[model samples]
Target: AGLSEAGLDLPPMTAEQRRASLELWQRRKAAVLYSVANNLATVAKDHAAAARVYGQLLTLDPGNSERICAALGRLSMQVGDLQSARHHLGRCAQSAPAERRDFYAAQLAVTSADWATAQRLFRSALDSNPGNMLAANNLAVICLYTGQLREAIRLLESLLERQPKLAIHEGLVFNLCTMYDLESSKSVGKKTRLLETVARHRGDNFDVAAFKF
Candidate 1:
């Protein structure tokens, strides 16, 4: 009964037991309920119930409203409810740093298919954190799709130089190698260089197929 009230599926419980569990849960401290909400989201994958818990937390634990809003925004995004995501993420972004603020806005713009705004906001996100490989990858993808092949290649190449050990970011590496194929007849050499770089960091586990050689 307690688990069900905490957003889990289990065998049926008597109405009296269910009522008792609800009373017990209502008596739980905010911190305990917060932990339960986290477990519901992470372990049980009960996002809807977790979101409700977060909404309750917003009023119960007002001091940590920003953090709760951020978590709720992320969960809304995960469930593909962009309207809810925009509301919560916008609230979180108001107090966030440039990287987080613009990244959230960029995600919203991308969802709306506003590539120009997304590109600008993602560039701001990357500029605020030079080592942000995800922002770099996002910017490069926008450039690639907009017919700016050289700019796309340059962004990824700059990321490689800035954070060489990040070869594990397969998407960035794959996008860079893809641009190499598009921009040069001698892509094999470019791919070889990328492979060599990956080999240094990944040792034997690096997949040769990622280079598209």
Candidate 2:
């Protein structure tokens, strides 16, 4: 990967300047390549290799340890290693900066269906980044589960207005609009539009297979 970044010759500069630029570029490329390799290795079911790359990333940049640790925790959760996920996420939650820790902790609790913890963490995340749409959306999710339909609709609608690109948000919106409206399941046209929006934004992180239109 370093060799590849070095291959991209920029327009002529002083020999020393060119050499320094290339050296720095190669280091950046190597970091990116290592991260991508880690992602692919995890996808290929090569957990050991992926773990090594993640560990390397930790050494390469201590400032980014929080996110890398979150990634490791998520992967651990996926592989049925809940104990490991909790262990690492707990460390990250304890020591990470508030901006990152709040969201990461929120995600950990949400994925486990711990609505109470998720609510608390999402509120914390929102306090740090008041305009964080995902955190607001997640808080709405907690409201939905807790049978606060009117409030959930308010939050979900607000999230959609701000960030319309996430398909998963569209799915959540579809559920909320159709189920939680004052009219409940009676607003046929809005329901149709929601389903259509879901299809339009379909691909990645959302499986519309069960949505029969």
Candidate 3:
């Protein structure tokens, strides 16, 4: 109304801005649709639908699409679509740059509790960087979860030696003992000594003084 009185109204949309706006809308629309489909498929236990939605999202935004594919593969695995899961994960793994590929692929395998695969990947990561505590810790967890009691203990022990008095070691000791039952774990002389130090609170957390990674 004020514009009319001033003989000045809003100008028509510019072609470039309009085009950009339209593209943005399309991207947002695609994202929303894919998100909705993914949620619905999760609720309905429809891994195929979820995969399709993720595929569409990739089409809409090719950059950073690896995460989307990884998510789709996770759902596919949940629904027993092993083939589809493998296919999507393979694509994501291959498309990822060398630096990021191993982590993503390792994560995918870890999600599925493919401990053997995780072990291999974690080794590769460690070989790449011997001081990668994160990789070492994750490998220890995988071992513990997969019934490799001795291996898990050895991992924690080594880390303790490398970085003693670390609080995370306490948690690791707790998990290992809880998993294997302290008695069974301590049945071995090496394990007994490790657990005794942990239980006695000699150094707190990791007790680096007594061991080396």
Q: Estimate each model's TM-score.
A: 0.61, 0.58, 0.52
User: Per-model C-alpha lDDT, please?
Assistant: 0.84, 0.69, 0.67
Clash statistics: count for each candidate: 0, 0, 8
Question: Which residue pairs overlap in candidate 3's backbone?
Answer: 158-213, 161-211, 161-212, 161-213, 162-213, 164-208, 165-207, 165-208
The candidate maximizing TM-score is: 1
Instruction: Order candidates by lDDT, high to low.
Output: 1, 2, 3
Q: After superposition, how far is residue 119 of candidate 3 from its true place, in Å?
A: 0.7
Best by lDDT: 1
What lDDT is obtained when candidate 2 is compared to the true structure?
Answer: 0.69
Q: Which ten contiguous residues of candidate 3 have the minimum total lDDT?
A: 204-213
lDDT of 2 by residue, 81-195 (tens): 7777887788788988768688778867866779889888898887887668767877877877888777777776665656555435544664555544553555657656656
Residue-level lDDT of model 3, residues 30-73, one tens digit each, is: 77877787676756766777677777787777775787887877
Runs of candidate 2 with Cα error greater than 4 angstroms are 1-27, 34-53, 107-114, 144-151, 163-188, 191-212
TM-score of 2: 0.58
Stronger candidate by TM-score (1 vs 2)? 1
* Native-to-model Cα distance after best TM-score fit, residue 23 in candidate 3, in Å: 2.4
